[model samples]
Target: MQTEPNSNPNGQDVLLPPDGDDVPRVQDLDLNLLKAFHAVYVEKNVGRAALRLGMTQPSVSHALSRLRLVFRDALFVRTPGGVEATPRAQRLAGSIDRVLRILQDMLDEGAQFCAATSRRVFRLHMSDFAESAFLPTLMRELDTRAPGVVIETHHIEDSQFNMAIESGRIDFALGHFPHASSHFHFSELLQERYVLLMARRVARRLELDEHFTLGLNAPDGLHFIAVTSHPQATELLERYGLTSRVRLAVPNFMVVPAILSRCDYALIVPHTVARAFSTPGDSAMFEIDDASTWPVNAYWHRRFDADPGHRWLRGLLMELFRIGAREPFDSWLGAPLDLAPDSAHNA
Candidate 1:
């Protein structure tokens, strides 16, 4: 096994080959060059990877050439479109990932983690609805576990999300999954249902039952309002037979509770979101569309699938909800209502 050259100013002791490990001896190889290697392998583009490393394209090309000569193997092969990892490159990718993680830990040793004592900044992207629902509680848990850690959140609109995640502009995205591609590693964090929200005054005017009889009979003047922060809102409303009217359309879901609190405007949003936005003394859920539900998912590029920090945050979010990847509606919803129309409707 070849030993790569020591690039750390702290000397070779910084990253020693494992346990007299039988890895190749690359005493002449600059270990710092591996950073470039990892970036190229992950990005699959020399020019883009160089840009990521803040280096010129020619320098990245030269470093890659030197690596190929030292290893005596063609690590990557260029296709007509882009570069593809060769067999050796594939094997090296995992090792490189581990090495980079260790490098990060080394750089932050002064900020030694006791978990109980570590304070760090984590970034996440979420739609407005998710921000209202999970950010508060998630922050509370973080405050207890890692009090110094600050969570920075960015809004991911339906239009800008796909590009944002792919380009690594955001760490991870949280929301009901749109009709997305398989390139992302997405996990279902929680199951949530869409609920109809109305002012208490309006709900009281309609003497409704579990079937929402008076709600169906309410005058059209109530004027349905829909939050378009998510693409699903409109489709969900149409699915439940309310497509003709949209008296108000807002991009932010957090503003919804205020709007509903002041007017007879009825809005549709997830149950968890509705609960979070409801002011204790000011608002209430007028109706819940028990039938319409979707899994709230955490999405990240496959490039980050094995990243320790990213994985930890995703797991923490799941743990806070006391649910696993595919929790059912019953696990979260308080009461089950069968929205299926039966022979009573036929009569």
Candidate 2:
């Protein structure tokens, strides 16, 4: 027997059996012991791991001895300045980390969200247009409510969201995902229409503004730019027999206005986004349709429905886009709702 001084489960000092002589049974596994292993795996130093876990270095070593005997492998070995995990330990760490998180969430059930001091990092999927239309207000809300919380926005399309969310890649997505899987929860944010954007001078010089308003076929000389992220953007143009008129295509929406400023090319964009770029002096906006508007929704995995943080964030988005912030947002987008939707509706 090694006879190392270690604290037993009853909080009494006891001599532990020689490592590998007495293996820990399944019932012997304790949360603290697992926590010690995770800490050591992450910190790579027993002393640092002990400090992180608020335990003495001897306690961490004792825990490691029992774990190594049970696993029948030296899970970690002393390297130059710290310990290195064996292949088996590396494989075990991921499962243990996930279990710990799930257990923590279970313990945090019914807890109130403290947004003021939260350091939670939220990941989101948003398009360039959605970012332009939504992020400013969201950032302002974060700045005022939870300055420490971090936001990461990824421009992933809806098709890959199922895998991304399942792998814990994104916390939620904000956009038009009408046919998402049943395992996801969705709430309406707002409805938005797409619009045509072109330089005001060019519109007048080419007599394009007059022709477009009259619902007449545009001249053959007109050319367009397409944003590839919304395939519907191109399809809608194709519906109008404007596919052949597209001279340039790109994935991002941010550069469209700059391109329109310098060129005679026209691009289709969401009305909210168009509002940001289409002032009366710069760009002209044209209403596409009122009856064909698409709803931009907030989507998340249904499993997070009861998570306090998820609920808080979801509520914040719903409030910002749906209830509290709706009127001002609509006013900013261009006009009142009952009169006529004055933006493009396809994208």
Candidate 3:
């Protein structure tokens, strides 16, 4: 039996076998044709695409012709300004770009990473408390090791966190975020505990025995300053039954020190923030008994797991901050955390 040949949208006859198996064989296709199509789709002009691909105009045009034949469509239509992609071409652009990116990353894995010569910029998302605790040590290390590398930090909203990491807008997010999708890779950096900060006069006025046992119903004229918008802070307040005594609601941890210094209000803050704010004769810090310890982690997309530049940075962070043998509260001080041979995965 014989079958009629197929006709494309432009009325061009596409030759078919006797059995009507019209699909092109994958083994017979040249990968370079796809590269040419990608260049033209991005540049929107044949001449510019040729320039980008380091090929002559006729060569690029020939590749495009073969691509059109295989797809059975006019992928792009020429106009006075440039070329406009057809619906079919538009649909394929994203997948093509992703494939090319993966190929490039694979090639880069073989190259050696030289910190002195690399001018890479790393983007990170971190809360103000993490900034206060981590940035100083990180900066010192970068200045000595990777002098040319630049670090840019941004504040990420909860709604945009997953999208931002997937799209490569942010490289690493540092804090106590929940477990991410399998597409993301995360390692615990350290564990953090909460503490209470109060003014010097208040600390001196309250008896030590009574202060430790103070209940939510104790009318000792203590008004709590709460970070109601943050999940961790809100949960901590409610767990200790201090939500009813809240006299002021703030949005972040950075402003708590300034507010507490001027008023009699007390704040429950991360141990790092407590250390930063508790200067001599100003504010006093006290450990909250039986408070839960939260894990601080560093997150990156799985695409960058093997990248040389990213691996170097992640290693440095792990070496500097990973909690091993030191006490949780004392690790944030100038003392270095113990780095045992078997504890490499903590970072």
Candidate 4:
């Protein structure tokens, strides 16, 4: 191994070899050699790989020779028809493809986004409530603007979401997430305050006004329906001394409306969800006076902060739901519900 000159400014020890080292470090590995390896692995023939790479056969051969020397293996063996990749070459193919794709995406970021032509797939992590409230409008916009784009949604727990975003399994997470780490980026999309949801008949029977107050004590004989995932909602219930009042605990907000319809239980949910569940004669929504407003944000890894496709998606969401936009989201929901002026405070 040939050692290069130490160029450390902070007096930290750094050991590296020159580019001609027998066993190259990651920094010393030639990108051309890796590209050659990928081409060879895909084409299975040196002549064809050279053609695909827009290089001469001898140049590709030389590049393959360097790759073999660096990897210490004959990555490809000659065959009668063409060539076959060795076990080592086969193992390197997947990683090399992923690297090429990342590079391509980075290159594409510099170009303007053409939604009409681009076929990008965006993966989102959202709760059931967010899906119910936002997906309809989001899909409509996608259909009109980016007909070729695909959207995949996953309902993942917050505990495992960081890993999912880091691994690129999820492109964006839209919901009330806690503070993110330095490796992640977040922007507030909407702010939602919790509200009480109950059947219209139940509300009428209890003599609850439009602005019903829970008072300092849990309402007598009130069976609370709790969403298992919302700790803040549960905490509010506990603060109002309503924990013991919980009779049924459900996994998500999807079934809360249905559960409240047949039963007389009161559910604490976001005002957006309350409005979504409330119908003219089925359910009624009321604002909680002392409720703390939680923010619904779009979270992504810091790595994608500058990605054009990701930025476009985030921009579209912000345009539609940010504090002030041309159209009211209530119109998108096709309901005459009145939204609080300060409901979606920007953050």
- The number of the candidate with the highest TM-score is 4
Largest lDDT belongs to which candidate?
A: 4
Error of 2 at 21 (Å): 26
> 9-29, model 4: which lDDT tens digit per residue?
122333434455355468656
TM match of model 1 to true structure: 0.56
Q: Is candidate 1 or candidate 2 better by TM-score?
A: 2
| Candidate 3 segments whose C-alpha is farther than 4 A from its true place | 1-110, 209-219, 239-241, 335-347
lDDT of candidate 1 over 1-347, digit per residue (tens): 55443222111222223234244566856766798899889888878888899998878877876666555555766765567777877998898889889988887764434556656577788767777767777877787887877788987666878778888778778877575558988878777777766665564455333356223444555567877756666776676567576788887776776778777777776767766765443444645444456778888888866665666676787676647644333344333323222234334
Q: What stretches of model 2 exceed 4 Å from their correct place?
A: 1-110, 157-159, 207-216, 289-291, 323-328, 331-347
State TM-scores per candidate: 0.56, 0.60, 0.60, 0.61
Candidate 2 collision pairs: 194-344, 195-344
Candidate 3 per-residue C-alpha lDDT over 142-188 given as tens digits, one digit per residue, 9 for 90 to 100: 89999999999999888899888998899999887784556889888
Per-candidate Cα lDDT values, in order, are: 0.67, 0.74, 0.73, 0.75
* Model 1 alpha-carbon miss at residue 202, Å: 1.6
Error of 1 at 347 (Å): 30
- Give candidate 1's error at residue 305 in angstroms: 4.1
lDDT of 2: 0.74
